[model samples]
Target: MHVLRKAILAAACTAGLAAATTPALAQTTLRAVMHSDLKILDPIWTTAYIVRNHGYMIYDTLLAQDEKGVVQPQMVEKYETAPDNKSYTFTLRDGLLWHDGQPVTSEDCIASIKRWAIKDSLGQKMMTFVDSIAAVDAKTFTIKLKEPTGLVLLGLSKPSSNVPFMMPKRVAETDPNKQIKDFTGSGPFVFARDEWKPGDKTVYVKFDKYKPRPEPPSGLAGGKVAKLDRVEWRAISDAQQALNALSKGEIDFVEQPSHDLLGTLKKDPNVDIVASPMLKAQYVFRPNTLHKPFDNPKIRQALWYAFNQEDFLMATVGDENYIQPCKALFICDTPLATTKGMDALLTSNAKKAQELLKDAGYDGTPVVLMHSTDLKALTNLAPVAKSLMEKAGFKVDMQSMDWQTLVARRAKKDPPDAGGWNAFLTAWVTADVMNPVSTAYVNAACDKASFGWPCDAQLEKLRDDFARETDPAKQKAIAEAVQLRVIEYTPEIPLGEYVQPAAMRKNVKGFVIAPVPVFWNMEITK
Candidate 1:
């Protein structure tokens, strides 16, 4: 690993030297080192941030959230909800065309929504209330609800996880479980499918045919103005090498620099580091309920008291300024945020945890914890988790792999020895978890639940009630109840929250300040 890194730095230094003498290219291009390699392309199939970023590069959404968290039309020119809130209507904007030159139609949007509903927790919940999603015309579609539903707009305009990225009808018709082969989209950038080499590089060109909205770009909504002619995503796994490349002008941006290296990057005059204006992301520790030890709620709850949030936060972020100990299932500072049952769990009582583990009949089986080593943010998580579990009198099997491999493996249902896992740690944009309506991790539906598949009938009912309840105070009350239930059942562990800042060259202007790091409206200059 050290030798490979040295070779990369040597090549980067050589390229930097060449760039210093050579004049800027005729066409503008932004070379970026994203958080990880673009292994998955279908954003609906997986909630991986790499794929979510890739989705933004090539696809357009019917609606999007702005910096203020307001939902605005993107593909939809105009939309209206019924007085009774039973039906909603949307009209497609003019000049929306797929990269292949096919016109964007309402049927395509309907199909995309249908495919998304299969795996997305919120989508599945929203669909239960939806009577039908039918096209009124080529440019218009209407969603008729079985009853009065309040989550329609929020559901369609959700900012993350199964993002409602509009695709061509054929591509949208692909099996929800399977990846799509088509890459056609009506977004501001056209994905260069031919140039895509999974682990090395992924390229995108400006969509000349895309027409920008009249409004100024805000968050993921409004005008998606492509300021650069081309964008290149280079996979540079090593943090030090990525920083070296950024400093040498070999790369235009680093999506996520290592937290420990932020001081060095900030000292560089040519580099500009910026944090997302959105809320800080939360670290989630999910355990497989189908497996041994963790299947017992008592054992799961014991981990809550054993695993110290501060330890995990310090290990993962290393900077106290950018992190906070938040025990809420709905991210801290959000409307649904609560500390109802976190008092005992967040205390970090190893003695109580051990007592609970003993009472739960923990059989001393090695807990298979999947660890993703490639991601700098996640690399230190497993070690911290392992230490805590061991201290709580449990054997742990720390299995290491890349983020993409971990993502794929977490979906398996086999026993630990047969390839399944006990637990893993990951982070979510605060927006994704701020409410039960959009939070997949909070869904307690048995086989149909998110990754870990923790089943709790009462928790599921509370979530459903929270979704249908129209009163804000009632919803908050329900959220507090849900948080308490989650704590008691122990589906997952909240390991605090932290902000991840991106580093870029000084000349890369017009970068979006949204939660998702978008390349649109960003220009690269010499």
Candidate 2:
């Protein structure tokens, strides 16, 4: 493993040297090392963060959340909600045009929202209350709901994965289950498809035709002024080499630096580490409930008691400064955060796990754990999980693959041995899982649920109740009930929480600090 890492770093260093030696372009271009290689371009098809980031570069949203988590208008010039909250009318801002130079219309937004609703958890919940979504005119649309609910604007303004990114009607009409070939959007940047090389680099050129909102940029809610002529997302998988490149002026930014290397980067006066509380995430362990032994909830419960939160946190994030031992399903320090029904399970008890396995009539089916070796933050998780599960008398078969491959493979519903997965580890930004409706993994909607396919009708009902109840006290009570049901079902385990900091050269300025990275309003200075 050490030798392979060394080889990767060596190659990256050579590439950095080449970049440094190349003649500088006349146009201002910002070269960045993103968290992962860009492979999948269709954000609606998968909940991958990289793809969502790509979506933000090329597509606009109807509304967006500010730094304070307040939803604000973006593409929508203005909107009005009826007193009953059963109807919402939205008018698109002027000068919105697709990459192909066609004016963005109400029909386009409606189609985009419908497509996103099919795949996003929050969108699905919001759709349940929606009666009709019709265009009033070229630039105006109205959504009529069967009942009053706050999920309409909230779903549209969701700040993270599976974001409702507006696209041309032609592109938006594509089936949500399939990837769209069209890359047309009306955002700040235009995707340079011809320049894209999946494993090496992805390119984007600023869309000169895009009109920035008049409001000052706040989180992802306001103006997205593209200050750079071009942006290049160069794939440098090695953390040390990426930082070395940044220090030497080969690259301007690194989306995620390895936790242990922060001190070294801090010593370099040229590099700046940007860490935000909104950037915190919760690592999760999801068991595929479609196949045994996970199909049996009791068997799933056995492993719950076997694993410890602190072990997972320490194994993945060695830096004590970045790690947090949290058991809250919703996320610690949030309004819905709670440790209800987690008292006995947060601490490891192999003996108790073994007893539960016996009570569940275990047939010794091996759990197929998928390990994403490409992502630095996720590579250690499967090994640690394997050790903990084996300690509890569970047979484990660990499979290794790149993060992109794992993202594609996790969607399969086949049996474990038939190219399907039994369990996998992934993390979500706090914004993605802050509440019952927004938490994709917590949705127990049977076939409609996120990967792992865990279904509990009662749990689904509780989530619906939480979404419907508006009273704060009543909502808290319902949220606790939902958390208790999640504990009882074990749909997904909340391993722990940690912060991921982004490092960049001091010359790269105006970077947004939202839950997800956005390249707008940023400029490169020589």
Candidate 3:
């Protein structure tokens, strides 16, 4: 594997890896396999990565995050903050037209912001300070704040789940809890609704009407030039098959190649394995606090001590260079990252866990672990978790399903026997979980909280303080406080961190290295 990686490294450094530039083709189409199937279409409804990717294809945001994580105008021509910092005014850019041939308006943006505010974690935080969101004119809108908020741009320009994606007012008026069927947006690509076949394939065509900014594309900001005429996101569940397709030039890219097969893929001269240093993800074990035995914090802590972060990290990502045993819930390499109460999770203490479980009156309740078989990155987690938990004297019931099934099923408040889950292992990009305000898993707002819904008033208050804190030193102190509380209240287990690299055909050029996989500014060379 090392030898193959070295060969790949040498080739990558050479210009030979660059595709031969050719004149643009009239009907260019780039076919690729995404990380998962596009089961859900509404980005605001779920935190699923596939839906977020789909949202980027069809919807444009008011502001976008650059590679440096700075907010820049996308749909907006420019924005101005009031002298008192109590109001924010924005004007929509010209040539912004919805897919349905209607002019984009501030009314549409106002409704979209309101609907998004209810769903997104950051948006919800922003809403607390917002007094009223009103349309000033056809293209102008203002958000008057009851009090000043520091995260206005950050919330609006967040590059992840529940992104402030603009839509027509009618479509944006849909309830935040309800999913919208309408898919009209004024983005660089048009969703080929007729061609979409859910688990089979999803198609997108470049919007010729899209007028990109004059400056070059930068992350999710700047100009979004859709060089390809069409983009097809095929659902290839088998990583080897998808890699084989990429090797044979049948597919232009593969979003995630099987970790075990990386060595063989590295040997192929036709493929280029690309990874951004900024692209870091942490594996997590989320316990449903609404049900037993996870509802008991002692029972939850038993599983925490029983499992080892290194064991899970090794099993998920075999390469040690790509994986790290991260104990910090805020993520490593970030300011707030600290191993405050991680000593319990550093080593697997099955004996200690068993003792705790017995003291907590363990009745051998079956822990319904949701096993996502289709997603290669998450498939091994259930088996690993089951083995560890059973060793700790806990009963395990592993449920098998695709990632999409898990996404929908996790939302259920039913008991284990009634198609509900006790806990499920998933991963989040480090950028998404680095801060208290950004991480959805750490939210402990009870019924109003994220999926796990582990409500703790103290923890929520600490997070709220972190959001309002302008001083970096104060924010770090608040973050540490939050982490200590997170350790005490095991809302979710932070397994570890690893980097997943995407593979693409040599002909697929100009791929953007953003936190989210974007197809814009990329072209296929003949």
Candidate 4:
């Protein structure tokens, strides 16, 4: 009996040792609530931030910007620029593979850049100087310019919406006017399209085959290591419910929490509020220049005269600490910032606005204004605009809809009463509007411009000059000229500027500070 007991005790000790050495098989999932529901998956189709964030998850860029806004190589292992700056050669890094197990080649990138250039504002400007973009070999490509210009690398390294996300040649060949059906990408995560629920949840799983860079992670650059096995973006539209979820540890992150409820989130010992200076944004009121009364630049200018930046700022962001009354079209406190032609327009005078309307042959046409109900920061903008415009002697038709629906409806060129909109309230990251060429709303390329379709030959000329100029002082002068033109044409109204912060559980770490929120290089600890 003693020998049998000794054998059993020895077996139990061996079992315990084996258990201690085994690895855990459970998958780690980081659940998050993004700023908006991701209805559009094609980043090239729209400039929506949600779609751009989705693009970052599944697509990789050839070049990226670091924390300091310096452009760096991402997919490209090395690159060389000619002395004349008319040609650039790029070589792709090794170990890069598509989500479908295909190798990433130079031909794929060339096709992707061509497709992106067709829709993006910066891309269009860069293409104006490009003579040819051809692949030299399976892994090498070159961009030959018509003349020397500095926009080649800058356009490719653009970090905001309409980012140059690389895809397979087959998918990239899709028409720019239509969305692509294929969702294959070469980024750190593989999109789980089979599990995507448009208004509920979107899932992404780490791509085991992805080879991260050896360098340390930086803002949208360097190594993008997916630390979690799975990531889920839950669509919780109600801000209070999202905050409650964060407080109770039900959700790991909230991309944009309501300013009023921020105090409630701060009271939670388990939550951490992260406010990054890079996340500041500018609110805009865009008018459709294809239809009246907004089709008349004079009418558009009248709205500007009636607008009060402080009223919009107060209504959207109640917390005085987070809002700013800015008049510069190119964001205040940045280079090229100016209020050149803004003094006469942004007066907030109802009588002055009425006088202008009368001078323009006052037609009491109802302005079809779109109100996005789902967005917390934008919900109050249309209401305030309606109140202000009505007081200025303009009939306003306030239409309500979710943000995604508005995003789609705004693209229609039909008459306002015929399934079209006259104007809408939206916001852009400060990074997106820093310059005349990069700003989408300010592009005056007629039919080729953004949804507003504000066509002005002088404005386009000024933007082209800004893009071609290399001198800082000359560029600033060109930008101010562009701003003055924008004020006169009134393509879009600059409501104000504000800083938005993200909230997450205390266990979430390594969140990268960038103009746009990214998921890689982050992990959640239990």
Candidate 5:
């Protein structure tokens, strides 16, 4: 993500493909069911993954990314960052209208930032790092930062990142905290309605009056327009029930079914299989600094020797060991991903692991391994890991929990203070973006007073340094330092990186598996 904004270059295509006999799906309603809902409704207030469903519908980021994860401009026509990097100037395009027919302006965003930065009325804590927001003119605005935040650009570009999303200042500011309901946006879709329920279902209707993004980098073909008139997302308990609906053509699609269904769907001509690599799987480990045994770097290093991630990926997905060890925090694709410490993190020497525990005087000591994952893409790897860790003379205890519970434990300071969790295994969704940005979301101590772990002042500084850094080499070095700091101190362990797969029915036209799924960009063609 760039410090600037999205340039809505109408995406162009070569020509048309063969046509099918299917009905025109745009006007037809599309029903989709997911395993769960993204929890928060207002993206600015919470970093909860589920909130994105709402964000994808009403809010529009200044920049939009392409399939290759390249940052492209959106609502913004152009912009520039100050030489010092503390301030960013953005120029908005004229005549963009919100759903209520109000002119979208810089003033709207300026005011919205003020609310999201410190007083996101819902009490959601995602924007605690924002410094300030100010407008220079009707068409221009500036975002001031606590530090030149490196992830600001990418954060802004995410489907629903923690940063401030623009809203019409007029209506929202009127009662500020009273109603807290404003459905106005300048994006491709407008808010139609929602029947909200926690852990239930929600429906969103499209704004027919929505303006089509201009030509040539045709936004729709490139996935910027909301092709369907409406989308109904349900929370169904049974995969068969959802897939049954899909096969009977009762629903358009369903997400995250058991592996057994993959074959069943492929054989059924009515339903097309949508298989997507979930995204980059990050290897997170607790550094030796957080607890006793892990506090010893030797024991920490011994972990790499204990894990057989490749074996795990093979069992989970043969030949699709697409989930491989990251080698380091900064992957090859991300700009300035810390490439150091990966080799140490991915080691699998059972004898050496035992020697490390012995040298550190922690041999045979039991350590807790908390997992938020439901199924190991590589189940076999667990036994291999257990054997290696046992060979190394360490007692491993494992437990599993739902994602929300896991988030509460990791982000909130509750039990597990007495090293209740010696260490944990999980993956990060870097999505081919820089590690620093996503890494923070996964492990950074947002508010030290509240988080269970002691804050690393060095990481805080690195976060600051990476933000303002302009020189690529300097930024890379800083990023590497951050990765090394995390690796050496291990609060969370990193095991492997994964690629999110975007599988759709063969008839699902313009389907893409972006880091965040965008409804406006999809179409069903036959």
Candidate 6:
């Protein structure tokens, strides 16, 4: 046994790989649960870096953000930025092949880029500034920009194909909405059939014919190559059911299940637990100047007093970990996190809430509250507003729906008004939405996007300028102003930031949970 162990160690050293380099697949597979399926396999529809980030496990990007946040090369073997920084030339590496054994080409990437930009069918706003992309050849491509937007590479290195992983223009532009599930791409895995049993599992098998990545490849920023033969993602929604499987050795891991179950799971010797609270933002949206009650900024401000966010998150999600009483549009970690100290000054006083309601001459009409599938977590939330609003001389009723339905409901102008809902509960994710302006546009009920609740135009203009302005001092000044505007002129109430947790068996390995789907560069090994 010692001799065999010695031989294996020697082999690993010679290959410059620890046993970790090629660890065996877990005997118990990696399984998980999400509130809903990440249904769209198409990377273009949503700016879903999380989904596209998962695609990096199978696909490739020209520049990839490493574990250390450096933009390292993955696919492009050699590249140079133009003196103006608006145009970039990339030379594709030789010999990279798709899983189907076709050579990976710049043409593939260029096609993907064109389809995303010029093609209106994709329906996303990314690539709005690109002038065009020129395919120099099978191995070379040039990108031209319309503006000197900062974070451009960060935008392109993005996990979403909207940013990187160009598809062959021919294939992508062919009827954008058509389902091309017969997955064929130059990645570690080919598109295997997506099989979901009615209430059982969803699995994606590795394409056995797939080739390993070239030492250096175009477009790929030298990202980590896939190390496993297959990756299987099973949707197990119930935290307890998923954790039970983990405990029974049916699955390899799970993330934070429940605080209540922590002690019992901790007692097991095989278990490894890390009390990592997820990074998330908890906030609210309401009609604004564009809508009736929200048309008055004072009323928006008045509602702020009605909400006890400190208690809301604790009782709703049962996670006091989200201690931020952030009443601004941006979460605390945001560069644009409220700095004017408005949240610090504001108190959740019901008396104050009533006074403001009376000042607004609120007639105690039934106000419809909108929420999504977070009903279980909403336990702490729904009732808190009833008496406060009633005391303020308003009657309120809470309405709930599934998350997907809620999201769809929000897209149409004045959803709460048209749909007969008065208030909406939602959370803005931290992705491209890293600043206050962007956050406000997406979540502020004041925006006409919330059905004519006129949002603060100053904030919107600041966000637009923030995206375009090259000056740092100027940008910071705009951000500071925007934060105060959100406080004084609220389109929505900033409640608390939150993360959804899942239960896993104690022995699960490589579960790096983020607010987004993070099934990349990780695996279960036992």
lDDT sort, best first: 2, 4, 1, 3, 5, 6
Worst 10 residues of 5 by lDDT: 5-14
What is the TM-score (0 to 1) of candidate 5? 0.72
What lDDT score belongs to each candidate, Candidate 1 first?
Answer: 0.85, 0.89, 0.84, 0.88, 0.54, 0.53
Report the alpha-carbon TM-score of model 6 versus the true structure: 0.73
How much lDDT does candidate 2 score?
A: 0.89
Residues 142-221, model 1: lDDT tens digits: 99998886678888898888898898898999999889877777788767665678889888776666888999999888
Model 6 lDDT per residue over 320-358, tens place: 553456655556665556547564333656688777777
The weakest ten consecutive residues by lDDT in model 6 span: 17-26
Candidate 6, residue 136: Cα displacement in angstroms equals 2.6
- Cα lDDT tens digits, model 4, 211-324, are 988888888899999897678899999999999888888999999999999987888899989997689999999999998798899888888889898999899899998998
After superposition on all C-alphas, the RMSD of every candidate to the true structure, in Å, is 7.0, 7.2, 8.5, 7.7, 9.1, 8.1
Residue-by-residue lDDT tens digits, candidate 2, 1-526:
4344334323432332101111133267899999899999999999999999999998999999999999999999999999988899999999898766679999999999999999999999999999999999999999999998889989999999889999888889998989998787788887777668998998887676789998888999889999986789999998889888999999999999999889899999888899999889999999999998999999988877999989888888898999998888999999888888888996789999999999999989999999999888998999999999999999999999999999999999989889998999999999999888899998989898898987899988987887788998898888899888887799999999999999999988999989999999999877
TM-score of each: 0.94, 0.95, 0.94, 0.94, 0.72, 0.73
* Model 1 weakest 10-residue run by lDDT: 17-26
Count of backbone collisions in candidate 1: 0
Model 4: residues with Cα > 4 Å off, grouped in runs: 1-26
Displacement of the residue 49 alpha carbon in candidate 2, Å? 0.4
Ranking by TM-score: 2, 4, 1, 3, 6, 5
RMSD of 2: 7.2
The worst-scoring run of ten residues by lDDT in candidate 2 lies at 17-26
